[model samples]
Target: MTGSFGATSTTDEVLAGVDLSGKRILVTGVSAGLGVETARVLAAHGAQVVGAARDLAKAKGATEEVRAQAKNGGGLELVELDLASLKSVRACADALVAAGKPFDIVIANAGVMATPFGKTADGFETQFGTNHLGHFVLVNRIASLMKPGSRLVNLSSSGHRFSDVDLEDPNFDHTPYAEFIAYGRSKTANVLFAVEFDRRHKARGVRATAVHPGGIQTELGRYMTPEVLQGLVDSINANQPAGAQFSWKTIPQGAATSVWAGVVAEADLVGAHFCEDCHVAEIVEGVDIRAGVRSYALDPERAKALWAKSEAMVGERF
Candidate 1:
């Protein structure tokens, strides 16, 4: 089914007939998993892909397979980026800016899952800090590097169905912390980011879209313990409709939507929607292990509010 593409698409299948010569793309977290795969297919199609990760050495080692996939002048290079820290985000943005090349597509793919309650370098919750705020700052700083018709793809998750952002206590200062909730809130922030980003920049020719790349098992879940994994399984099982099948995606299957969003002209043109598989997801009324985007995630007012709060937190305006 994934081979046939469409709602069940894989990375290469969508790019199979496309040409990306002269295109420049950026993918975060390319050290492994979906990020590597997303880069691989794009490069294979003849795009120049710059992959950013925290550990350049690890990324260099992990992207070997990705390099092997390059064809048609598609090439991959590693850049140092650690989204958990604001300083690192700035440095990476600075490096990219100095390179003086605007990206045609930006995939904010690197992220963390539910972990033991902890804070990032700037004292924000681990999941919220890295998954949302970090990307928020980086994208803002790098906005100037996106020319008109640029595509910005943020890797959101079906987990956004799990909860909405708690604006008052995103950092867990005023409210009690729950790892899963933190993850959900961060994912929600991802969708909201696209909403506001596209709203703000679409007129300038930059388009932004968010994708829930399905439930693929990846390094994004490294922090989930056996107990946590089982709990996730149980929660999913309980919430899903009767007889709904549970399927974990292969890496290729997981990256289909992000790649599709980046290269497909129609998708880039119709931006600011959260997608699953390779199509715009329907607005779901309530969460029950369904695959549609949440109302709160797409709420315009909430998106604006989150954008303002993010600017305030990051101490910079885009």
Candidate 2:
């Protein structure tokens, strides 16, 4: 399945002719953008989708359209989740565990981007808390529900190339806060989470992987200013030939790789890898390689370390 698809692939295209009847999927951040599209397309293919959002009312209203899109035994439902708060994460996981329905796929698709400095209710840096530790606690709490042959897709970002997790200072406690760096570390944490989780759970027949959905125009960029955006573009293209255009993918294109990861039964994809354009991404060799996994993000030792630290922070060990 290597490079079978590219940035232009649509969610519908990756899933065309695939039957997901009897499959139940859990998708976070399903209120808008890629998450909504992911749920809709999977449901369209006959998967029962349980979408999680911070606001149940908003989720209920938004998922109405997703429910309408369901066909052939496909359906959509809602669950309340606030990833910025540990209590909310536990409640969401508890509710799902109580339901006793195991998911065929769980997509950790919700996340915040480079927002200004702030702390989550848990007193951790906002991005690291919501994007990484939040899912960390939620997943560990409900891991029993992810049975053998299940997939967990964590939505990472190409921004992971920007930096590695500062384990000792993950909350920017003693260091000056930089929004992009925090975001980068969190995204890196996403990849490492999948890595260690897969290593630990593979024998149980469970697998995990992280995905880079490519650049897209979405609310995820709500905190991004023009100056920041231009700086990123300049940094990414710094070594490339002049006049080469930087591009953004459409929403469907952004969701394609995730949908692919959720359903593809390839054993080759069972390990932790940074995926992009529907395939495992290779590191671009240079001073400014922005399209693939950084070595630090995939280090098994670091992954294990992060897991331990996260468990300590959340006061639970899984």
Candidate 3:
């Protein structure tokens, strides 16, 4: 399936010649960027998409194109989900469960990037809580809605290379707080969550995988100052081979990997692994290049430990 796709593939290109007619998908963060693009392409290809966002009015406006382009049996529905608040997360999951509609694919796509240190409504560090624990509880709470043969696509990032989950001080009570470090920990948690979730549910045919959307100029970078953004670009350029400077992907290209992993890529190839550029990423370590996944992100034991820690932090067991 990935034979012809790469970093530059767009979402529409990935699903070309494919029919999604009766498939129902749930995508979070549909109010902007890749989430909107992902939902639009899938619905345009004939899949019913349920979009979740913290702001309904914003999402309603953002997804107008999705509704306008929906075809065949495809359609769009809106739901409210504020991942920073456990209360909101649980409420969203409960409402979905009560609705009793099964999802063929669930894309945990909403997230925050580097932000000043803060805590969630539930008192977890903002990045970890919003990016990881919020989706953790919501996904687990709604896991029953995902049937056999279903798949879960978690939107992780190469930023995961920044740090692993700091289980001992997740909230940074004793450690210094750094925005990118927190973002990295949460991203790593995203991958590990997929690892453990796939382990526990693959037998039931529910597969989960994580993907990096590559560098895209999205609202996800709203928090970064020009200097911060420039610093990152400089770092990438410094690490690149001569004349091969880093570049940003278009929104369609950024979203390709998510939809590819969710629908186009073979389940066996993507399940429980981290992917980028529409293919399973190789595990590279002991270097600082802005490609591939880190070994720690795919470690099973670390994934299990993070799972248990997540359950405890969320006060819910799966």
Top of the candidates by TM-score: 3
Top of the candidates by lDDT: 3
Tell me the tens digit of each residue's lDDT in model 3 across 1-318.
Answer: 666899999998999988999999999999999999999999999999999999999999999999999998899999999999999999999999999999999999999999899999999999999999999999999999999999999999999999988999999999999999999999999999999999999999999999999999999999999898999999888987787678899999999999999999999999999999999999977436878899999999999999999999988999
- The C-alpha lDDT values of all candidates are 0.87, 0.88, 0.95
How well does candidate 2 score on lDDT at residue 155?
97
Candidate 1 to truth, TM? 0.95
RMSD to the true structure for each prediction, in A, is 2.1, 1.7, 0.9
What is the C-alpha lDDT profile of model 1 across 133-198, one tens digit per residue? Answer: 999998988899999888899999988987899888888888888877888999999999999999
For candidate 3, the C-alpha RMSD (Å) to the true structure equals: 0.9
Candidate 1 Cα outliers beyond 4 Å, as residue runs: 1-4
TM-score of 2: 0.95
TM-score of each: 0.95, 0.95, 0.98
